[model samples]
Target chain A: MSGPAGGGRAGSVLALVGNISARSLRVWQRNRDVYFVTWKTNLVPPLLEPILYLLAFGAGIGALVSEVQYRGEMIGYTTFIAPGLLATQVMFQAFFETTYNTFVRMYYQRTFDSIMTTPLTLEDVMAGELLWGASKGVIGCAVMMVALSAFGLLRYPHALVIIPFSFLAGLLFAGLGLCFTGIVPQIDSFNFPTFLFVMPMFLFSGTFFPLDVLPRWAQVLAEALPLTHVANLMREAALGRLPADLLRDLLYLAVATIPLCVAGIHLMRRRLVK
Target chain B: MSPVIEARALTKRYGGLAAVDGVEFSIRAGECFGFLGPNGAGKTTTVRMIYCASPVTAGDLRVFGIEVGDRPREIKARIGVCQQEDTLDPDFSVRKNLTVFARYFGIPAARAEERSRELLEFMGLWERKDARIRELSGGMKRRLAIARALINDPDLLILDEPTTGLDPQSRHQVWDRVRGLRRQGKTILLTTHYMDEAQTLCDRLVIMDHGKILVEGPPVDLVRSRVGKEVVEVEGYPPGLVQHARQSGWTFESDTGRLFIYTDSGEAVFTVIAHQFPSERCTVRTAGLEDLFLKLTGRELRE
Candidate 1:
């Protein structure tokens, strides 16, 4: 490598991230392409969990509440809960990459220390990591979204918007993923947070049922969780029928995402440099 | 031209203990300066401050005449550092490793490619350009690290113990490359505990012990000034050698019974050693940097 003897602005902070991210993406695809294919290979199995629930819980239990009406319309039980499952997968995959993968690169691999010795500063490091997380999340969510659409569960005429909404929903989880990485000392610490935070959200974030179906007090608690807002916003956007409380849900998730991201970046800088 | 590196009272403290105490030193343009110290003598700490990786705890430190206390990036941009540890990315090939590091300094892609090839060839790794980092040998890795540090055509190069772990063959190869750079008039600041390496590569050096400077000067001059013109080294531990020499009207210091008797008459000293200590193993030798270091720092190992 030659020194910046003929120095250029191309090595500016922003340019460095863009260049490294571009190179890293190629490395990721070549090295981690197997991981993507492996996740895809097993993806068929995960889809079965929600499909079985819809068939058994929706079809089997629809007989009891066979004729529920809302807004002068009658909807099938399976149709009501399928979108929630899709959003749950987005949260799951996004958070999984952000926590375990990021923790390894940050602590175990010592990759940031190598980069920091270059012209790139701490901010560029954080940006590059976040960009990687977002790209991974987008890939996983896009795959699942296509699979869900194939099942004839949801429809969107403006299908391109689904990509951005999925990215935003994935980013919200990515932010929280980094926040968890900052405090957890080891990869093992990730398991408890996943069990405590991720598992509960997958179970209780109105994924398997409507929020109104819960008791009033339980409904209030669920509303404050970011995943619930993400699931609600996504279900509305995918179905092309904005919910009555759509503004509130979207605003709540937007607020939560910004602070979580800022906090995560702050903690990462402190941890890496320390 | 400005001094290549400058520092005043630079110190680094690990909690309460100072690894590098109030040390002050500087190097001017195109000079090969070295820090000769035993392990834990804070040579590594001093090198880090010049490279602007480790923070200065209390004193002023500058690189390329820029105050590293505030403008580290500006200082770092003009210089290159090869840290003590191997931090190369294992996933990258030899060629990609150099090119990627160049890009981090904002070198253009096309220019970076040309430089990477030139450096890989210079370090005798062009044949292994496509090899992964894990596939390279220890010596190859060290050469690559040195090559990578030079990629930016840095005004100053800071090497922290460049050849400590290499075998003799690899060490000689590295020494040749470093000597080639020195001939190009690139200022180099090096730190090593190996006395031979400091003696061979450095024009002037400072011997540090316990975060303090014990002595500093050109290698040969430092030896001549400290230990006289010549030294008679009697290898085996001599019985009462210090007393024997002093009583014999000669000046000497005994290190674990190895007598280093300094005098202008080297042949006369050996004659006296052979006659006085017939059972003791003896080898007469001219004084060099090692004797000078032993004299200043003593023979005891520092941790």
Candidate 2:
């Protein structure tokens, strides 16, 4: 009869979302010491990775090609690689927040199963997971942006747009992370995705080197990637530049976001509800 | 009293295996109904379908007369389930677990807190309310799980193997709480393999084996209707003990090296057993739920 698909259900959904947010906030507040521990164990080490990359790749490789043209503007090799490092940090944080932490809740600890027997539906579970991933991504990416600014690699008007772009980066990877957890056969299956999907995207998504440097066919493959659009968006926003195909890049990311989120929620419902 | 739960030919199949096959029963209001079966006899599966956690492969199921397939949320709102495993969120403290679940049913924070505190005190967990779940023992965790299930003050309470792996002392404590709930006139549907548990707690039960009901009645009537008046259990392999008991006019059923001799005089059979197999361990007891279960479904392990 299509009865009672009323606005009342929407109010209930909002209440569900608020409940999950408050619970997470309380957990974070009570476990403030855990944030410090995670910083020491997970966040601090990766902050050094970009510095090492500059020393090893930028300085070492800059000798052969002192400067490169990206889209239109000319920039030094070290400057080109630095902003890409920030994008990589966002990707990793978003991925880790949903996949690793949520996996423990889903399988090892079974925390979500416990939540499901209550009034919370599968939709609430997915929303909580995605919200946590986005939060972690924002915190991690902000730190990286601050670090880049201190190093003089990031500029003002262009940098103003990076915050929103970082949110998109978080959404993209958070959605992908849920899909990954759903399909992965075992914990060890993550190794193949990291090495194959993550590593290649980090390397070939016009992050380290400009897309024009690649052959025409290789450039086609690069444009097909979700992170390529994200890295391009970051570079354009951070360096005050935009790709000639800006609308296409936005369209590519939007396509990735909608489907990944829908797929993620579907798989999460199957796993958590029953 | 109107029936609180009615399931007709309810079935569930995983892959090609029929886990719950054509299970049918109705639980009356304010009565304790149990599904007594060994492992893999589809107790949990049937419970899952009734709660609408798992979809029924084929059959009709209704809780509080609301059809499950058509209105799951309506049905779930009136039921509380304590699953076999303790699935509490280890990240949250004991108190947070109750309030978090209570909010799922759309309860306000103020009311949820008030009810959470009440339920925690009811379950004797008020002192440890703020402690993380990882810190609690098995028995404490199970009790907390039960408290969490009751947060909504559900009309129908369902438990799957409630006291599965508890010490005798802890089992008794949980049983007392269950009895209290029964006194409060909450309808309970539980599943367990423990015969003593069934005999002690269940007002009526269905003895199940291989996804089918073998018999159903009150605990005392089930024993009297299915088995003999008295029973003697011989522990060791008493060679020729079954034959000797039969020759002495006592009916016998041998199960797992334990011979169950049924007769009007339990002490007479015990005397025969003691005189014939003096070295063997034997006990003379009233025929109870265990004998009825063994008589309906043989002693072979289901799994």
Candidate 3:
């Protein structure tokens, strides 16, 4: 069943991979075109989000907290949470793009169905959507980085790496979001994952403080969340302090992204192709 | 030249129920072929397979002499489908819809722009090229969908219920545009339940029901062979009129207060029926595809 006839489990997986090509870029291009049309509205949120977080959490809370312990030294509380904000922005941008926005395009706009009628296959369409979702994160990161730099929050050349790093983090969250999009029965059903999965990670993923402050079991759970690795890398870059242990976080993100993206494509195929 | 599309024992099953079961047909190049069936008759499912939107459960289906299951991209590249629903990109303007769709077929950007202009003009949508999809009326949207389909210069075009929900004027306009495409000698496949639509557009067609083809032929031929050249419908028909038709070995159908007689000679049938029934109650008209369709599929409402 698994030989040259292209039957059986392994052959089906191979077929799915074969269906994707550079044509997936066409899907990305479509989203880019639509983005440019409403780019002004898209720009407002990313620009304002970091400033609001900086004012509320960074300056307002930092006044009382003063400083926090980092690698082995004390850093300003405002500076500590600044990079965390950037990391969270990557998560929100990529996650929302693939979940609610992608759902609208898939179910409401019927954009995927239109693209599939051409030479493009379902795999190509979903892959393009993943790439576009990642791009949204990268764009949001850039916009927020500029706003953060205005307050002397991010460091120089080391901070430049955060832009590219956001893309990898973007792909991971985008894949996770698409998996949810594929399973949810309706658009309203997304609230379940948004609250249960995303909200929990947003609050407990070491975004606001160090994991050491939490109890042992809570600390272990925080380490398992993908955002913890993302926040760790962002803090390392923002402070211009690249510890050797940061490689562990980088390896974890790389490992998690590939499988999530593959699963994302397969899960979307189940929803779409029949 | 070989046939443009061929299907042998084509089947598509959703779990236990077969949506399209063992359907066999072939479409010659440069001819307008149609699949006429009521709802749930597998017309849409069959067309979806030809366009590679749905997979075949079993047997063989081919387009442009290539198997649909293998290298679907190649077959899909050569065919354009205007689906049953308005699947246009509502986010983009009318002109952007065409140009962006052209890119999916790997058409060069410059050529895509040039084709977008030409197709918009061809579909009489050149003036509203930049208008958003929501702003366009139903007919305009449908025409733009057809224009978008032509952006690739596809060799075969499949229109699934192209004018399903349209006013008479819009339906006529769509038919005119479709006739224009036919004059350009493109191989077209259309599926419609409207019998008049099939008779007006199709060179040859098949009537399908219960996931099977009941009959296939030219509209006029099917009407003449299955029904007849003419029909005499008798309102307030008498009981002896049915008895007279049966004794004369004439093909007829009886309703509550009407008797329809199918015959090659309409005047003769009308005269004979009117002799027993009132002349004012009988009227003769030319037979059509609707008569043949009803005769084959029955008058029962299909869910």
In candidate 2, position A173 carries an lDDT of 88
Compute fnat per model: 0.20, 0.31, 0.69
State the interface C-alpha RMSD of candidate 2. 5.3
The per-prediction CA RMSD against the true structure, in angstroms, equals 6.2, 5.1, 1.7
For model 2, the stretches where C-alpha displacement exceeds 4 angstroms are A1-66, A241-244, A268-274, B234-250, B267-282
* Clash pairs for candidate 2: none
The true-versus-predicted C-alpha distance at residue A108 of model 1, in Å, is: 3.5
Ten-residue stretch with the least lDDT total in model 1 chain B: B68-77
Best by lDDT: 3
Q: Is the docking of candidate 2 incorrect, acceptable, medium or high quality?
A: acceptable
Superposed model 1: Cα runs more than 4 Å off: A1-94, B235-238, B248-251, B255-257, B262-264
Q: What is the descending TM-score order?
A: 3, 2, 1
Cα displacement (angstroms), candidate 2, residue A66, comes to: 5.6
Off by over 4 Å in 3: A1-10, B255-257
> Which pairs of residues have clashing backbones in candidate 1?
A1-B151, A2-B151, A2-B152, A3-B151, A3-B152, A3-B153, A11-B106
Better of 1 and 3 by lDDT: 3
lDDT value, residue B42 of candidate 3: 97
lDDT of 1 by residue, A1-274 (tens): 1112343644432333332334333333322433543565646634565667666766788667654343356665556566677677678767877788777666665666666666655556665556556666666656666666776767776444556766777778878898888888788999988998889888788776676768999888888787888777766666678656878876776787766766676677657642
